[model samples]
Target: MTTIGILGAGQLGKMLAEAAAELGFKTHVFAPDADPVAAAAATHFTQADYEDIKALQKFAASVDVITLEFENVPVAPLKKLATPIYPSPAALEISQHRVREKTLANSLGIETAPFAAVRSPEELRRAMETVGVPGILKTCTLGYDGKGQWKVATPADAPPLPPGDYIYEGFVQFDKEISVIVARGTGGEIQCFEPVENMHRNHILHTTTAPANISAEIAAKAIHTATTLANALEVAGLLAVEMFITRDGHVLMNEMAPRPHNSGHWTLDGCNVSQFEQAIRAVTGMKLIAPKRTAEKVVMTNLIGDEVNHLESWKKPGAHIHMYGKKESRPGRKMGHVTILSPRD
Candidate 1:
């Protein structure tokens, strides 16, 4: 059986492992420590620091193909691996830095919020002048789930700038936030899942409803934009594009994640081919499967922090629950998710 190596052993990796097993692929999960969630789902687990080159090489040698669950994996170490990595380190680099990501998006004629690179306090001040108040100051790298982000409502309200590069983006009055997941094969074929409307709580994803209540035209445009980005990056796996739909119906690109996304979790129960399966197929050079929805509608709600304790209460018809094998859950941490499939209301 072909063995697949995954770089991060998070819940996403766990899901990917499950999908791999369903497809008769042996999965080896590598992380700093043995992640029970991934280990339970995968065939093997390697516990070693990412900086340990020898360990990485050994892990790479054991797998037929390699992929990453997260983009923050060190590129230098990945380059040393003998096996090929899907989505490419270049794609990860672009997704790692906001400045590079937005710049590349703009180069592709994809609309993004007004943004300026801020390397120093003076530059931030200048960026404030350019982007204006009611903006967001974010680190160029390693920011997610509302971390490493500061809201700047006014010049005085702006927090003391942290060390390192940042991006100042003018706030956009968006009607709703949606995300499209596009998977590209090595042969340059692309399959885009239906766009999903997402709701956030305290800047963390709360719920995602597939087949977002939007006009067919807007959905088509969103899918096209996501497909264009995936093709431009020449990514082998999945590329998820988060976008903001303005009140006037214009879709503005927000961010891109070059892997299975939280929004696409609905596909697990609602679609014939889930995002995780598609990612594995892409990386392994297997035939790509079209993402066809098997349900009329699907709603996925994240179980964050204490939400996991209430899982037993959610037992109802048509609800599929997935719990990551995490021992402890801190505030703002994702514990699991529940997807409900139902006919259109």
Candidate 2:
């Protein structure tokens, strides 16, 4: 059996392993976590730090191909791995840095919120002026789920800038936030899932509804933006593009994830082919198929932190519950999710 190596052992990795098993592939997960959540589902597991070059090399040699569940996996270590890794390290590099990712998108003629790079307090001041107030300052790399972000409400609200490369982006007044997950095959064939609407609480994803209530024109624009970035990056795995739709119907690119995204979790039970399955298929050079909705309407709610305790409550019909095997839940931690499908009213 071919062994697929995964670089992270998070919940996403667990789902990918489950998908791989369905296709007759064994999963070998490598991560430093002592109790990786993915170990429960993966066929094999390796506990090692991402910087452990020797371990990465051994893991690479053991698997037929390698892929990552998260974008923050160090690019330097990936370059040393001889095994072919899908989505490419270059793609990972760009996705790791907010500045680079947005710059590339702008170069591709994709619209993004006004942004400026900041490496110093002086630069921060200039960026705020250039991008305008009521903006957000985010670290250029290594931040997610609202971490490493600070909001600048006014000139007087500028806190002491943290010491790191940051990007200042003007706030966008949007009607709705949506995301599209696109999978590309080795032959350059692309399969895009229908755009989905996302709702956030405390800057963390709260719920996602499939087939966003937007005009067909806006939907087409969203898909085009996603596909354009995927093709430009030559991604062979899943590339999820998150965007903001202005009240006037303009689509502005938000950040992106070059792997199965949290927003795409609805696809697990609501679509003919889930994002996790598409991720594994893409890395393995399999055909990418168009995703068909299993229901007219689908809603996926995240079980954040202690919310997992209510798992039993979500067991009603049409509600697909998935709990990550996390031993403890802390504030802002994602414990699991429940995807519910129902007919449109």
Candidate 3:
């Protein structure tokens, strides 16, 4: 059996391991953590610091192909591996930095919120002139799940600048937020799952409804934009494009994650081919399969913080529960999710 090496053993990696197993592929999960959630799902778990080049070399020698569950994994170490990595280090590098990501999107003619890179107080002040107040200040790297972000409602509201590069984005009045999961094969073929409308609570994803209550035209446009981005990046794996639909009916690109996304979790129970399976196929050079919704409508709700305590309450017919097997459940941490399927109207 072919062995697949996965980087970052989080919930995403756990799901990826399960999918790889279902497809008869052995998964080797590598991370610095002593015990990761994905270890249970993987055939082998390599616990070593990412900086340990010798450990990475041994891990690479054991796997046929390598892919990452998260983009924050150090690209330098992976570059030295003889094993092939899907999605390319270049694509991962671009996704890791917000400035590079936004610049790439804008250059591709994809509409995005006005943004400026600020490295110091003076640069931030200058950026304010163009982005104005009521903008978001985010670190150029390593920000996710509402972390490393500050809202600037007014000039005085701006927090003391941290010692690093940042990106300032003008706030947009959007009608709804949606995400498109586009999968690209090694042969350059692309397939997109239906767009899903997302709702966030306290800057963290709360719920997602597939086949978003959107006009066919808007959905088509969103899918097209996501596919175009995946192709432009020359990505050989799944790309999740989060977009904002304005009240004026225009779709603006928000962010891109070059892997399985929280928004696509609904596909696990609602689609014939789940995002996890697609990721495995993409990285292994298999033909990309278009995901077909098995249900008329599907709703996925995240179990965050103490929400996991009420897991039993969400257990009902047509509801699928997925727990990440995490021991500690702290505030704002994702514990698991529940997906419910509904008949089409």
Candidate 4:
């Protein structure tokens, strides 16, 4: 069995472990927190700070292959890992910061929101003037699930005269948000799933409906864009690209995650080979299966905070709810998610 070391212990990592097991792979999960959700099912696990080089080296020494759960894993440890890491350290380093991400996107002839690097109040002011108000301020590093970012719809909402560094991005006045999830085998075979329309609540993903209602031409563009990006990044594992579609039908690059995305979670029961399984195949150097959605329309809803505690009410036939086994429920925390696959009207 090919041994794999996963470099994060979030729900993504947890599900990846499950997929790896089915393929006869032993997974070693490493995270900073003790007894993470992934640790529950992973064959082996290590709890260590992400920056702990010694711990990372030890963790990497044991596995034959390494992959990451999220893009936030620090680049240093990934570079130090003994085994080759998929999705490429190059991909992680570029995708980690918004400034770098947009730079790369722009370099590839992809359109991104107008943005500028803000390391001081002056830079922020100039960026505001250059990019205009009704913008977003995001920390260049360590942001996810809407954390580490803020929107300034008006000048009053502006972040205080900034000593702290940030990336200022122009707000996109778009009609909808959509995402494409793709898995690229190490041998370079690429398989893509249908694009999904995403709805957000307070910057947290509320729901994702697959086969997103869009023109066939637009959908084709989205898929082609995703495939091009995955290949361009030399991505060797699962990757998801978030995008914004203007009312006029222009597609703008939003950002990306180097693992199975929240928007793709509906695939758990809605597809022949879920994103989890595809990720496993990619990282294990196995061939990827052609994606086949179980339903013409699939919807996934996240269970946040106390909503998970009352899941008994959501317990109904046809509703597949997954709980992360988190001991406590806090506001905005992703306690679990539910996937529902159905035919389109």
Instruction: Estimate TM-scores for all models.
Output: 0.97, 0.97, 0.97, 0.96
Give me the displacement of residue 328 in model 4, in angstroms. Answer: 1.0
C-alpha lDDT of residue 83 in model 3: 86
lDDT string for model 3 (194-277, tens) is: 999999999999999998999999999899889888988899889999999998888899889899999999999999999999
Q: Rate the local accuracy (lDDT) of all candidates.
A: 0.90, 0.92, 0.91, 0.86
Cα lDDT tens digits, model 4, 1-345, are 378899889898999899899888899999999778999989999999989999888988899888888788888767766688998998898877788878888888888889999887667778889998889988888787787788876545765654655898998999989999989988889999889999999889999998798999889888877887888888999889999999998888889878888998888889899899899899888889999888767889999898887878867767898988888889999989998767655
Q: TM-score of model 4 relative to the true fold?
A: 0.96
Q: What is the lDDT of residue 120 in candidate 1?
A: 81
TM-score of 2: 0.97
**Candidate 1 lDDT tens digits, 126-227:** 899988878998999989998988888766666776579899999999999999999998888888898999999999999999889999999998998899
Total backbone collisions, model 4:
0
Worst 10 residues of 3 by lDDT: 153-162
- In candidate 4, which residue pairs clash? none
- Could you tell which candidate, 1 or 3, scores higher by TM-score? 3
Name the Cα RMSD for model 4: 1.6
